[model samples]
Target: MRPPTVLQGAPYPYRANSLNLFRLILAGTVLVAHSFYTTGNGEGPHIRGENLGGWAVAGFFVISGFLITRSRLRTSAGEYLLHRIVRIFPAFLVCLVVTAAVFGPVAMLMQYGSLAGYATTPVTPLQFVWSNITLYMNEYSIGRTLSDLPYRSVWNGSLWTLYYEFLCYVMVWLLGALAWFRRSAVLAVLAFVAATAAHALESVINVAGLDGDFLLFLKLAPFFLGGACVHFVIERWGVNPWIGAGAFVVTGALILGVPGWGGQASAPFMAYGLLWLATVVPQPRWIAVNDVSYGFYIYAWPVQQLLALGGLGIGGGALGLIVYNVAAVLLTFVFAWLSWRLIEHPAMSRIRRRVVVPSRTGSAAA
Candidate 1:
């Protein structure tokens, strides 16, 4: 039998990849990047005007696009939406509550040394929780807490992307209904191409001083669609190591050489490179088994805010940054762990139970 090549590949085991570990690392990268920003140190690093956090968030969308596309293709629309909702909503709602009730009071106490008048404050705890409950991020702060901090009054700045992420999910779901999109690899490639072009076009628009708030959608869509494109490529041809390497080379060139549109154009290559790395890189069993990336991503900002309120960040140098990060990670990991155990996993498990489908032998299996 002939060995599988890039054009015609062998079976790839989905579980063999180390995507979970990559996710955790990306989540940590966001935390580190925010450490610089929340402390007023500036965006830590940039490649072609995109900071580390921006890159990390793009990585997140890429990964999500790939996985969520597969998920949408594999299940009914109802099941797919259910899984997405359960995966996101429960933990998010609970995080809002904890931030409002627990972190808000804690920040108030740490900053003003009193919780007096916290309830009547504009955008109170209940209001904050209720407003952002639908993932629209209607409120960013609870009471006047953290208002004086560098980042200023935001409990979780990382949350603004959730709304966009869900919007992308809906786009994919809508596209998935078309048989041409589902069956034709060409369609996936076209989607990726169109998204990348829009991203580049938006970059050009910003350079011409026509930027607006809504352009963020164009900024993020390419990466997500890039992931979706890779999924189709994998399904049709296979995971090709050589193709992946060439993609990395392209990505590096676009990122380093091009000024305005380079990063935008590199979306497909970046997605492919990450996917390739997942295949080669090994993951720790603990991390592979239990994903705390979402929890960490959601909780890190508030934990850092609380630290700043306690007067930790903003003045000191490297040592201060290290201390702040160490403390934040430890505290935030505890919250993430609890969130996974108490909220995300349990909610997902209940959804899994409800997602019963017929087995090949004419029996129902969950």
Candidate 2:
């Protein structure tokens, strides 16, 4: 039940937090991409399917695959899951709480005029906690049935991917735990292939108007597999960092130019390429330090929604976006620090306490 501690009392390895830094940038990319939706621009060159934001998602998938696999390789399955939950949930709950506090009441009053049913809404503490903790809320419920309204769904739409990432974690963990794959490298390839097949099938279904739900599977699996490939290549055969970085650039360019082509298929190759560069890059003291990216990603959408509700509109073009980003950045940093200090760290410590069996028990078992 105990969560894993921070990489051995601070000063972690070189690549430890770099992917997280990349995720921060990707979160911003998603914001900008979604801004297109908010702006009512349906189709345009810069805001097309292959926009920066799409790439950002790809990056996230890759990171998840690589890191989760690495975590399993380095620790026990129980510890890996605990670390993930502790790192992810506390800040996530905080975000839900803050957003609901700032927006739920105001939106209710503005729309419903009397707050008659505010207590029953998704933003209510009970609803938010229940929906988020269970993770199946999104799948089972329709609009606002879970913890989000229709328009407000975008508030944390980025997290939809996290659900899939969680799935990926389970799959990867099972594969490793069961010794299903002869090598991590083989597992990586299988994941990529599966993801690619899923995506291609989804695209076919969408084109035929058969279904849209399949898109979810297509998007989630490949990127995750891609990340795993990167980890396998580097950790196993020891590919050159520069070669990896260059491959990443090339693959990235291809995807940007033609995003509709089974992007999930290409992500693993690209992720490994980029990861190669990550390995070669000099480890800055700052990079290896604490990561604030997850906090940024989880909180930004909710904060932006709250800001919009407050009439601090992020609609004045580039300047407005900049202002929103700055405010979100500051708030996210504070949240991350608090989460690390008060909630995540303390909870992890408690878990550790529970994990270490007493000497009497150990002697008896021995």
Encode model 2's per-residue lDDT on 40-113: one tens digit a residue: 33322352366666677778788777777766665567877777677666666665665555445555565445
Clashing pairs in 2: 226-268, 244-273
Candidate 1: worst 10 consecutive residues by lDDT?
A: 357-366
User: Each model's C-alpha lDDT?
Assistant: 0.82, 0.58
* Candidate 1 structure quality by residue, lDDT tens digits, 160-199: 8888898888888898888988886677778778766766
Which parts of model 1 are misplaced by more than 4 Å?
A: 1-10, 203-213, 353-366
| C-alpha lDDT (0 to 100) for residue 283 of candidate 1 | 94
